[model samples]
Target chain A: MIFSYELLAQAIVTGILIGGIFALISVGLSMIWGVMRIINFAHGEFLMIGMYIAYFLTAKAGWDPYLTIFITTPMLFLVGALIFQSTIRPILKDPSMNQIMLTLGLSLILQNLALVVFKADVLTSSTAYTRMNFMLGPVVVRGSQLIAFVGSALTAVFLYWFLQKTESGRAIRATAQNREAAALVGVNVRTTYLLAFGIGSATLGVAASLMIPFYYTSPTVGLFFGLIAYVVVVLGGLGNFIGALVAGLIIGLTESVGAAMLPGSLSRVLTYSLFVVVLLFRPQGIFGGKQQ
Target chain B: MLTVKDLKVQYGAFVALHGVSLSVTEGQVVSIVGANGAGKTTLINTISGLLRPTAGEISFEGRELARLESHTIASLGIVQVPEGRKLFPDMTVYENLLMGSYSKRAKQYRKESLEMVFHLFPRLEQRTKQLARTLSGGEQQMLAVGRAVMSKPRLMMFDEPSLGLAPLLVQSIFQTIRQLKEAGMTIMLVEQNVRQSLQISDYAYVLETGQIVLEGSGQAVLENEHTRKAYLGI
Candidate 1:
């Protein structure tokens, strides 16, 4: 119950790093929701799937977490595209509730499938960077958190460029705004949706790979991060990328500081409490008005 | 350079467009006028590739559009400004125009297209950074037209551009339509505003209950007793 500057600084710094990771993870959800107009309840399953893929690649082939990016990113992209084409895409014109149900079913299917493949047992990874740390004033920067922070920032930059500069990126944005208008303007909305899903899934893949060195993984791993990510998506605004970025970091800091201040149970309660408050006050989120 | 022949459309058991046909020669300003639910939008939707025809053929620049995709149709220089000014509400005025050329125009030309759009609608240029939803109704209509013009289409379709405009704004929009026609752009205008649409149209087609009730030169159609009494309210 005593106040300490070192503890406070440490808490804030840790929150920022974790927030970066959360931002990177939630951005895809935001982008998908913005363009496709679906909440994608199964997003957490995709994250879990990425983690397992990283685990198998590292365990079997002795690949580094970074190396797993090349493999898992593309593979997850394809997986995401397939999920859209097979299930999500078919019911795209249906009501929003139907789309939500489809993705929820997808989540269940993916979680169970991972349970069958990787089992309910927990798994983790080791890297030279995993245990490293940096000392700044009274605060410490753990290696895993640093990597997650830097990696998440880099991924966010990449996604921003992809959405703004590239033609395909613009097409995806157009599809998000007005699918019919996009079609009328010569945008292959179908392809754009497929590409957006792929890109979104690929982001999760990167997130999963980065997480292996730091966090334990199981079939339910996605549920933990996925819940945080959903909170981040709404906090940042449903489909706004920059909103997600700011919201992610803010939530990260809040959660970190909360943990330092209260017991773990109370910290979660605080986080959710903040979520409800933010929802009530500004349901659109901080950067809600901005488009992806 | 556009021809729609016997285009048929159905909504469940009800037929909206039963073998309706229209044609637009190169650089001609053709208008289609009908009352509410008279299939004007259905016809435009079919032509723009938003809706598929149950039967009939649509050909633009000699390419068969019956089975082609909507984007493909647009890339071939057939663009449509839909019934509502479907501007991306969250995007800036400039961003909406940029999205107009999103599929066809490249980055290098984006600047020029933006300039062209700005020149066409000075109001949009004045509020370039403003979100589209914040624009006035007339400005939004202008933004919609400006957005479509960014594509530089071979054939452009307008669906009720004056749907919610004031009288003065409607006159300005008609003047702009005339200017576009003078610029040698082939346009297919769909409107319920009969008098103004007929005034500027090179040719006019009157649709009644999804059928072509009258068709002729603009002057002739304006003079037609059925068209004048029912539509022009003369």
Candidate 2:
């Protein structure tokens, strides 16, 4: 295979745009994992739910996909809180194996529920700009891809600021580092756990709403993004927010360029191979995450 | 400023603390010294709301603290520097200190608090940008204390501040504790280093088998036959 500057630039641009969406998806998963000490197997299903909600809202009420954030963000936030309270909270004191199994069960239930309701059919938002693109020099960026990338970047920044600056935000950071210590410092850690989980799920919802305009959604749509998200989170470092952001972008570019250079299947294999390498060498990630 | 009456903590069928009672007056440095598994950590942990007592009453500043969350207890100004420097290893030295002051009041006076902490342990200021995990053992202990100090607690509890340090570093840490005492901070020092703990403590309690076996003025406890034999190695 031969390489040209034009092809390289286009692949890189595509990678970056895709990376933004991956960032949006992975950060929530990482945050929840960091603070709650739980791996939410249902994470991808929540994204699927968000995409479906956006699809139906647009199909029925004629609402814009971006505008659906107003409804979906808060809705998902509430749903996340409820899930934490009902499902996650009860098993929190249990062993890690129990927590993982429970969340995995919840994910299966959610995905099948979507399958039952939406009938496993692929759906997408019929936005006018879905196919629109603008050329920059010899490269071009699809409007929807740009939106997914920019939206995720902005949301990641907002979350970073919230975690660092706000009192509740500080509590989340504290809980992530030391739950008992955070509690000792007057951080309502249980409440913070619920909030972190909620925020994590909402981030997925945000990603889903953004994604529907750019990509198609099925009951199993989460499976596709889920694999990528798992890669992104592991590559970025477990529970490191900023690391996830950087890793998302890096994975995005790698996937796009790799696909362009090699067979598409080989590119995915190469992408997954990066995860294995990172885990083997730098398990802590590019940015040092939690020490243990 | 604080009182623990009839405190009993149990982990399922196993009781870690049994009817423990103690008190700390305002601006006093109280020490609780005991052997491993003697419930020193359990007592502090219960008081800090990390563990719920099966039966007990803990009151701080005239308010009941039994049902309050640990963070709520912290907000009431009862902060504990937990055993093992539980610093966020990935964070910088400065960030670890900032986490101590996560409370609203601490945030409001962060600059003043940071200055005071730096003054006490100037080494932290020099390595403010370095990752906390990279710090030496003594430096990590300083960072732990420095982090707790940022909270501006009305009563700060140190849980084995001298656990893992060199002899020289241990001496300096004890000296720092004395300085904090002179600076008028209400402190509860829990340690296995009995001799040093007794020396710095204004009042001391000896815990054995989840109960207080002895309580006295610091010197009196130091002079006790048991203290002399078991801890001071006299």
Candidate 3:
């Protein structure tokens, strides 16, 4: 195979745009894992739920995909809080195995519920700009992709601010770092857990809204993104917000570059291989996990 | 006032506290001194609602505390500077202090409490922007105590505050405790540094093998022959 600067540059640019979205998806998953001390197997299903919410508002009510973000963000946050208060909170002190089983079961229930209600249908949002494209030298940028990238980046920045500047956000980080100490300091650790989980799920809300313009959704759409999210999180290190962000970009870039270089769908294999190599060498993650 | 009467904390088959009783009145400093595995931490934990007592009564201001949750107890004004500091390693020193004032009771007084903490430990004031994990050992301990102060605790508890500090740092920590004592803050101290802890204590209890074997005014407890033989090495 031959290499050209134009081809490589174009792939890199496209990878970055998609990578931004990928990173955003993992941020919520990482935050939940960090603060709640649970894997949240239903994390991807939360994304699916967001997609459905966006789907209904856009395909049924004729709302713009981007405009639906306001609804999805808060709605998903509430969904996350309700799920946490009702189901997850009860089993919070149980062994990790039980928590894992509960979340895995939740994922199944959510998937089947979607299957029953929405049927085995692949739904795509037909927005006015879905097919729009732009040219920057040799790089062809899809308008939907650029919008998704920017939307994802802005949401990530907002979440970062909430974690850094707000009291609820500080409580979340404090709970993540040391639960016992957080409690002793008068931090309502349980409430912080609820908020952290909600914020985590809320990111998926924005993500689903952004992706629907370009991406298709189905009951099983979560399965693919779930795999990508876990890979990014592990590569970044568990409970590491900044690390997850970086890993998201790297995974995106690598996936695109590998696709351009390799034939067929072998690019996925490259992603997994990189994951394996990172796990073998730096199990704590690329950034070295936030040590207790 | 904080009071624990016949508190018996057992972990399944293992008994950690065997019917211990103690009390700290307002404006008084009480210390519980014991050797390793003497259930000192267990007693403090039960008082703070971190551990449940099989048979006991713990009350603060006449309100039952044994049945309450840990955070509820903290919010009610019984804050413990936990062993090993337990500082949020990832959070900044200021953020850690902010967390200390998270309860409704502490929120209003946070600004003044922070100023008081900075006055107590000027080193912590300088490192407000630094991560708690990055601080030196002594600085971390100071931050821990400073955070507890920010909680506006009615009865502050310390569990082995001087465990790993150097001799000089331990002396300074004791000095700070004395200062807080002078400020009319009621305190419950658990320490292995029996001599120093008792010196600052108004009343002291000697815990041995999950039981309180001796109790008296600080001077009397210090002068006890048994306490001297086993603890003081005098």
B126-152 in candidate 3: lDDT tens per residue?
888999888999999999999999999
lDDT of 1 by residue, B1-234 (tens): 888899999988899999988889988999999899999999998888888889999988787898888888887878888878887776677777877876544334677767777777788878988888888898889988988888877788999988988899989988888888887899899999998898888999999999998999888999999987998788
Better of 2 and 3 by lDDT: 3
Candidate 3 per-residue lDDT, tens place, A182-212, comes to: 8887777878888888889999999999998
Highest lDDT scorer:
3
Lowest-sum lDDT 10-residue window in model 3 chain A: A283-292
- Isolated chain A: TM-score per model? 0.96, 0.95, 0.96
Q: Could you tell me how far off, in angstroms, the CA of residue A155 lies in candidate 3 after the best superposition?
A: 0.9
lDDT value, residue B51 of candidate 2: 90
lDDT of 2 by residue, A64-92 (tens): 88899888888888888898899899988
> How accurate locally, in lDDT, is each candidate?
0.86, 0.86, 0.91
**Model 2: what is its DockQ?**
0.55
Candidate 1, which segments miss by more than 4 Å at Cα?
Answer: A1-3, B104-119, B122-127
Candidate 1 chain A: worst 10 consecutive residues by lDDT? A283-292
Q: What is the total number of backbone clashes in candidate 3?
A: 0
Better structure of 1 and 3 per lDDT: 3
**Each model's Cα RMSD:** 2.2, 2.6, 1.6
- Candidate 2 residues lying further than 4 Å off, grouped into runs, are A1-9, A136-140, A257-267, A277-292
TM-score of chain B of each: 0.96, 0.98, 0.99
Model 1 residue A274 CA deviation (Å) reads 1.3
Model 2, B2-52: lDDT tens digits are 999999999999988899999999888999999989999998888888899
How accurate locally is residue B152 in candidate 1, as Cα lDDT from 0 to 100?
70
